[model samples]
Target: MTLFVVSIILSAAMLHAVWNAIVKTAADRTTMLGLVALGHVIPGAAMVVLLPLPAPESMPYVLASTLIHFGYFYMLGRAYAHGDLSVVYPIARGIVPALVALWAMIFAGEVLPLQAWGGIALIALGIQLSSWQALRSGVESGVGRAALGYAVGTGFCISAYSLTDGLGVRLSGNTLSYWAWGAFLHLFVAGFIGLRKRNTLAALRPRTWIIGIGGGLVSMTAYGLVLYAKNFAPLGAVSALRETSVIFAALIGFVFLKEGNWIRRLGAAVLMAGGVALIGTSL
Candidate 1:
């Protein structure tokens, strides 16, 4: 990747970590998630009117991506409910790059070079390392097992949408239009979650709205950048670079969520940075 692309992807990574932290801290994750989806719709509804419709060729990918994202949000909410942010975030985000790379090669015909593969492995290893101490700290087997299962499911959903949007944006001919449409589609996810949490919505306070909506905007911008970068770089490489967000999430968990074992996490961050460097140099 060029410096410009790398910078955009890194910024996206930070924003993504921040939003996940916001969700991780919420008392009612499903309700908070619905509000976040509403945040996307609020802005997206306006943009859809202003922006031109995406190409017909891109609509299928957009619809596919939207459906996958619904599953992503559902699984993510469940994962957070069952595990710590540090543990859940790493496993969920860590596995996506490799999966995206594999799918991109198999389905998208995007072949990565050797160094890029090395970088992906290093980043994946670092991500797993970041969560090692916590996973080994003797949490209950039942909760731990459930969290792992949910986290892995969330990872698969992420990879599904990552590839879907990456190709969708490319086919759309206009990144902004594609992004707006994708955001607008979030209404379906919001409505689904909202119906499930209908009894809880009226009770949500202003603070919850602010956090959820604000985080949603950030989340939208972060993924928007990723979609844009996908237009210029290999999907797998871009996805691997984006996994650096795991480092940010670990720090966020340590500082804000009062999660412990900073030394190991910091070490993991270094490995992630090294992996990023390898990928950047290869580009």
Candidate 2:
């Protein structure tokens, strides 16, 4: 990725981490997830009129992206139900790039240079190191262990959907079309799940809507920027760099929330830096 592209990806990663942290910190996790989905839906739905939709062939990508994204929502909800942002976020975000890289090699016929592959290995190890201390400390106790499992499962969906969406959008010739339509599907799937559980309508706390909307806007901007950039970059490269959000989330927790252990966070920082250096040098 070019510096400009990398910078935009980093900015989007920050926003991505922030919004998820917002959900992870929320009083109503599922509702917060739903609202974020709903928030994106309105904006995306609005874009249909203001911009011209692509040709008929683009619809498959749009539809595929929608279904895959719905899977993302479902997995994310279950993952959030399981644990803390610090514990779950890194695993959920970090693991996908490796998978994306592998998937790209198998299907996309995109081969990584030896050095780049090494860097990716480092990233994989770094992600594990991010949680190394916690895992060793017997950190996952009771619910935390369950959360870890759920979160990892959610990460699988992240990888699968992203891979599918990346291919879909690239084929569609207009990534925004796929993304906007996917937004609608996400909300629809979220709504159905919510209603089935009788947890659909959250009576927003008097002030929560403001925060939810703020988070949603950030979330949307981040996705838009990343998806646009993904169009130019290798899918694996894009996926790997996005995992930098783990470091950002750790910093946000430490600097703002005054939570988490610094030593582990510092280790995460180093791992993230390694991942970036890998991509930076590779590019």
The TM-scores, one per candidate, come to 0.94, 0.88
Give the per-residue lDDT digits (tens) of candidate 1, residues 1-283: 8989999999999999898788878888778888888888888999989999989899999999998987887787788778866667778888999999999999999998899889999999988888887666526444577788889999999999999999999999999999999999999989998898988988888888899999999999998899999999999999998998888888888897788689988889888888888888887
Question: Each model's C-alpha lDDT?
Answer: 0.88, 0.73
Question: lDDT per residue, candidate 2, 203-245, as tens digits?
Answer: 5564776777678778888877877876787778888877777
Find the 10 residues in a row with the least total lDDT in model 1: 134-143
- True-structure lDDT of candidate 1: 0.88
Number of the top-ranking candidate, with TM-score as the measure: 1
Where in model 1 is the C-alpha error above 4 Å?
80-84, 138-140, 144-146
With a 3 Å backbone cut-off (N, CA, C), the pairs that clash in candidate 2 are none
Model 2 TM-score relative to the real fold: 0.88
Model 2 poorest ten-residue lDDT run: 134-143
Candidate that scores best on lDDT: 1
